[model samples]
Target: MPKGKRKGKFEHRRTEEKIYSSDEDAGIDMTIDNCSETSGQSDLKSAHDDAENEQEKLEEKVLEMIDALSARSNAARAGAMVSLRNALQRRHLAAVLCNQRATLADHLAKALRRGRDGERRAAAGLAPLLALQIGEEGVEEFVNEIRPELAAAAADKSASLETRTEVMSQTFTYV
Candidate 1:
């Protein structure tokens, strides 16, 4: 008897020996010749890359809107300011804006000092949120760089009392 056929009462489950010239001949599925790679992993990587690209485009658009705050048209500037406020509501977007704190502070300071009433109010509202997002270091930088303009705005007789009050409150909070 063959070695596989020698079993009696305790017969081996695989009593028949299989000879294979190829994997398919031995009843093996050869679809996945390489087990190291997975289709799901590639799909996940592609999705992640797409998300990153979309995020980058959004950041660029936000920066362009920030620059638009200096537009000559009051309507245009107001629209841009509104867009920026909405964008900054997202924490990651706020962090990205905060990373360029110097430029942001400069633009905001300019808005506070020279922009129309709506723009000034928008800048005042955004300052605290920006400070909060960037934490202590950002607050310090904002105070050091933009404080004078804020002080000037607070004292500007042309500005609405409500706007001035808001600026003063933010200044005290940062200090």
Candidate 2:
């Protein structure tokens, strides 16, 4: 092709924006329409409110579970730990959980120190999850809160072999 023809083609390519004609050709709607802007803003606000409500509910449930941790029944405590572990695994509740780390760590330690094998195991399983939820800055604080009980549990031969192993393994998760 002649130089002039090549330059013209290049200029066209530079000036022309690619357009998708079909919905399948684009990932989102690219067309502009004079829809009411308030509708979009309202939708955004509604979504934000819904998310805040959901998060608040999750925090309340977790707090209830923490209270359950103090129940006299071993099964109740273990069940609470299991629920907490499942919840932490499913969602990141760092902001709420960070504030509760001390309470959570203390409850876990109490379970390890006094609860039966099953409860102890559940508490051990939850230790790392607490560390994770609290994030790096708080890991040391969390560990400090629970380390004594974890150490005692690890040394307690009366604890079931499985429970001891679980405790040992989870002890390494944050350390």
- Any runs in candidate 1 off by more than 4 Å, and if so which? 1-37, 94-99, 132-139
Q: Where is model 2 more than 4 Å wrong at Cα?
A: 1-35
Pick by TM-score: which candidate is best?
Answer: 2
RMSD score of candidate 2 (Å): 10.0
lDDT of 1 by residue, 73-135 (tens): 777876787787777776456557667788778878888888877778777777776666655
Write down the lDDT that model 2 would get. 0.87
Q: Under the 3 Å rule for N, CA and C atoms, how many clashes does model 2 have?
A: 0
Structure candidate 1, residue pairs in collision: none
Task: Enumerate residue pairs that collide in model 2.
Answer: none
Tens-place lDDT per residue, model 2, 41-159, is 99899999999999899989988988888888999999999999999999998987888878888899889999899999999998888887898788888888887788889889999
- lDDT, candidate 1, equals 0.76
TM-score of each: 0.65, 0.74
